[model samples]
Target: MPRTGDEFITVLKKAHIEWGNHRHTSTRGVVYGEGYLQIPRSEARTIGIFNSNSSNTHIFNCNSTDGFLVNASIKASGSSTANDVFAKQFQGNGNLRLIGDWFRHVNAQVGDQVKISWTSPTDIEITKL
Candidate 1:
């Protein structure tokens, strides 16, 4: 049996992830909590977070010209066709930049990186390395 993007997230929700909220803006897209997160890896898999609201739920796009994707996986709900998710990481500046990708992680310290994860339907956990 194969799982859709949403179904895949269901499984990941049980992982060792911290939880936080996702706030979206017209000029800035979306941010996980307040500011940048610290990712711990030079090369890593990023997690994009979106609000469960229908306006944003139908799609998760992060093909930012300024962001770099290490790898990604998108899931679509076979049963509902409405549930979906896109998990990808974007690189920017020095740290792995996360802009149009999903959540926010625009800053970091040397030797440390930033990462994002889904905390809830409308929340994301910003992991700092």
Candidate 2:
């Protein structure tokens, strides 16, 4: 459950799957550890009425109205952490910083940046200054 802006970018670069970044911004749907992001049209049957994943990781909408376009990737299944979370998912605003299409910023933001960390086994801490 990496949350810091920088860490998020790293996680996205690693993941390479689509988990449905379902979210509602106008409704203020995205929480810290949890999310209102839910199943997409493709995975509607698999996830069923359960619109959102507790892990709050999957955020791939493929241009869906439910959520915005988050720049990240995900791994469906492979590592042990996947089970605890989801097959794989991405749920964050922005972490990838592309500089001139050839470089990127070490930190997503310079200072007073957003910090996301694990506060408990089933929770995450987000500090955006």
Candidate 3:
């Protein structure tokens, strides 16, 4: 029999597979833990990390006008607050960049595991697992 959505999510969660927007991936990468997170472009696009239509070649720098701002409430074991996560696409590697102090607030570090998913269409929740 076919499994329900919640059941599928449960399975994904157990396996540490990334899932959202009817998409899932098992790709894993190293965490910087330096107040920023870089997500694989393909996975980020699949999970709707930012508006898909947003330019993926935009670089973030002084006098920047290429990236977009995401207002999200990041919830970790230690904190829960609305924060601004600047979303940008690396011009060279095309990775998805989420820059903010949220990582510091959550006390993320190298080798830490995190699960990012959409709590709603407009909300993303990141949990350190």
Best by TM-score: 3
> For each candidate, C-alpha RMSD in Å?
15.0, 14.9, 14.8
- Give the TM-score of each candidate: 0.23, 0.20, 0.36
**Sort by lDDT, best first: what order?**
3, 1, 2
Global CA lDDT of candidate 3, please?
0.30
lDDT of each: 0.28, 0.26, 0.30
TM-score attained by model 1: 0.23
Candidate 2 deviation (Cα RMSD): 14.9
Positional deviation of residue 13's Cα in model 2 after best superposition, in angstroms: 14
Best of the two (1, 3) by lDDT: 3
- Point out where model 1 deviates above 4 Å: 1-54, 57-107
Q: Residue 83 error for model 2, in Å? A: 14
Candidate 2: worst-modelled 10 consecutive residues by lDDT: 97-106
Candidate number with greatest lDDT:
3
